[model samples]
Target: MHLKKLTVVALSACFGLSACQKEEAPPAAPPASEAPAPARAESAPQQPVESMPPATATAPGSGSNLIREPVAAQEQPLQAIQTKMGPKESVIHLTSAKVTGQILTVEFVAVPKKRGDGRYEWLNLTLPLKNVSYIDDATAKKVSLLQDDGEAYMASPLNGTGKSIRLDGHSPITATLKFPAPPETSPTISVNFSDIGSFDGVPVSR
Candidate 1:
């Protein structure tokens, strides 16, 4: 009886140790796709973008800038003629005629004339001005004023305005008219001032 009890105790101890070993065994290996991924490296910082500057604007030349003066103000010594004008008449006297290179300059003063309405009008002339050139003694051909590329006559501006000059009735305004010079063979030329009539034997100096 004692031998059988000892055999039973040894078998029970062997079974308990086997059950503990089975419970403590490691878990089954997971599938390759289910495994945790490796960690990623940190990225470098981004740079900032710069903006461009705006363009600058430019201006064009004004009317005053384009006007060229033919003669200086001081060089022209104006004289006051006491003689008056009659009604229904416009008077212009050729004071001086000067030939310089290819140009012939004629300086004249317009006498304050009485209008047909009996009102006295002073000299008021416009720019890019035009005048009558009826004769040239040298060529015997009618000479015209020199024209620029813009078709404007090369003449002094009426005033600093590049426009017209307006003078008071009491004061005489001396103005200049330029024409293409006649041939050097003639020291004088006849200029017909349209309705004002022709000024013959007008002397030309250098």
Candidate 2:
């Protein structure tokens, strides 16, 4: 009888304690991500993308003319010389190379080729770089390929140079061109080059 009485008292006490305890509310849900494109987020700096490389070509003659420019001993033996807006003549070996006012001068290295009899031929062709195909991907408003031939050719008139070209019969060139600035679309000027002739007194086929 006493055990039964004690059990009832304990149950009554637990019920009383439970009635005094407070209930907790559920936690708030996470904020939705439908965020508006914030203007500068109040305070954050911007960043730009960037990778670049410099480029350069050889001059008219001498060590850089051919022998040492590309690699080891000169490969092509200079042959005939032809010009589009300049002079055309049977040029001998490369005599001398000099850069003046940005124009590279290639003087006859060998005695000018002789006529059937004995006279020499005058040169007339300008180096060819105009036909070089390139694509202008720069921000420059416009881009152009200046041809030594007295004209400029562009892959796209609004803004372009050349995307690709086959200057050398077997050498296909593909590249993107970059210009300095505006209306001067002519991003760069250049010439087609070849060196197939007599080297060190030996007649070599071009």
Candidate 3:
């Protein structure tokens, strides 16, 4: 009977020890997808952005970085005499004068007098002739310049209106005369057209 009682006690002790070990065991591991992620490193501070300089604007139609300059005034032409001449009411009008380098240009207009028939009948034709014989022809041939010091310069036919003198009584004939340049210091000069009077006190300019 004692042997039977000792066997039951030993079996009871073994069952109690197994139940305590089961209660003290660790929990089961979680799945790989449900695991906690690692921490991220902190980002560096942002740097300040640099600004560019503004570009300069230039004038329209001008080169870059260049300023437009003002233009200078132009040289003006010289003046001349405008008047009548001769007893027959012929006229000689000086329009302008210009000196360039060594040449002198003189622009003028000449009007011839109307002819009368023996102091009675007016010889004025019904139609003005395309070409007329007039006193300006003599004037053109003998036109000259008398300087302040009495030095005379003849008209240069090569550079001026040659021997061709056209006269129309209905309207004045415009002509240009070229001459050798006179001394710049000449205070005054006279333009003489023989049988057609003279233009005195013409001031000289360089």
Candidate 4:
């Protein structure tokens, strides 16, 4: 019994049983093609696999694809939250998606730092969109592009090499989401938010 919104009600029942197909709202993170790219974070970030105390995520089991919902989503229980983010507790708690139940991912690395001294440095990022378009920027921050029936879907202009971008905060940086065609059997339901790594800020050069 857990389903905050079940990926927008299972993507509006897979685009069909729609009475009007109006329920868009999930786009905020678009603008980064060139201008602001200086947090190179050499290397650091590793001691974080010693787990044995962190639980509180139930609901995600109706059969498969996992996205169940009946009622379950109040959040804030997994060890109280915040797994890493010093100097002010930026926000951490990276990734967790129980192939059959939980789906926890918290991250907001604005400028977090702490490498070489540790081993796990990161500015990670992970979301949805198997077919993308929109890549090039200075970051003023104001993303918007939803479509499950609702509307609003524009951005999609940065690719062709600027797409294979890299963050190297320790590893991780993949992009590509801006579909319109060539997609009919891959996006039945998707929703993600990842970047877990960094609780101590530093490295700023905008």
Candidate lDDT (C-alpha), each:
0.59, 0.33, 0.46, 0.30
Q: Looking at model 4, which ten-residue stretch has the lowest summed lDDT? A: 97-106
C-alpha TM-scores of all predictions: 0.45, 0.18, 0.36, 0.16
Q: Quote the RMSD, in angstroms, for model 3.
A: 20.3
The residue ranges of model 3 lying beyond 4 angstroms of the native Cα positions read: 1-82, 112-161
lDDT of 4 at 154: 26
Better of 1 and 4 by TM-score: 1
Highest-scoring model, TM-score: 1
Top-scoring candidate (lDDT):
1
Candidate 1: where are CA atoms >4 Å away?
1-90, 113-131, 156-170
lDDT of 4: 0.30
> Which candidate model has the greater TM-score, 1 or 3?
1
Model 1 gets an lDDT of 0.59
lDDT of 3 by residue, 1-206 (tens): 99889999999999989987776553433444345432121222222112222222223436532433332122343233657464346556766556678766666665556556423222221211112111122223332332223232232222223233334445445665556555565444555554455565555455
**True-structure Cα RMSD, model 1:** 17.9
Model 4 over residues 119-196: C-alpha lDDT tens digits?
445654322232322211233222223343424232222233333223334432222223222112221222222233
Candidates 1 and 3 compared: the better one by lDDT is 1
lDDT of 1 by residue, 45-151 (tens): 22211221211111223333344233444456544322233223445556778889988988776666666786666645332244557476766788766656766
For residue 72, model 2's alpha carbon misses the true position, in angstroms, by 37
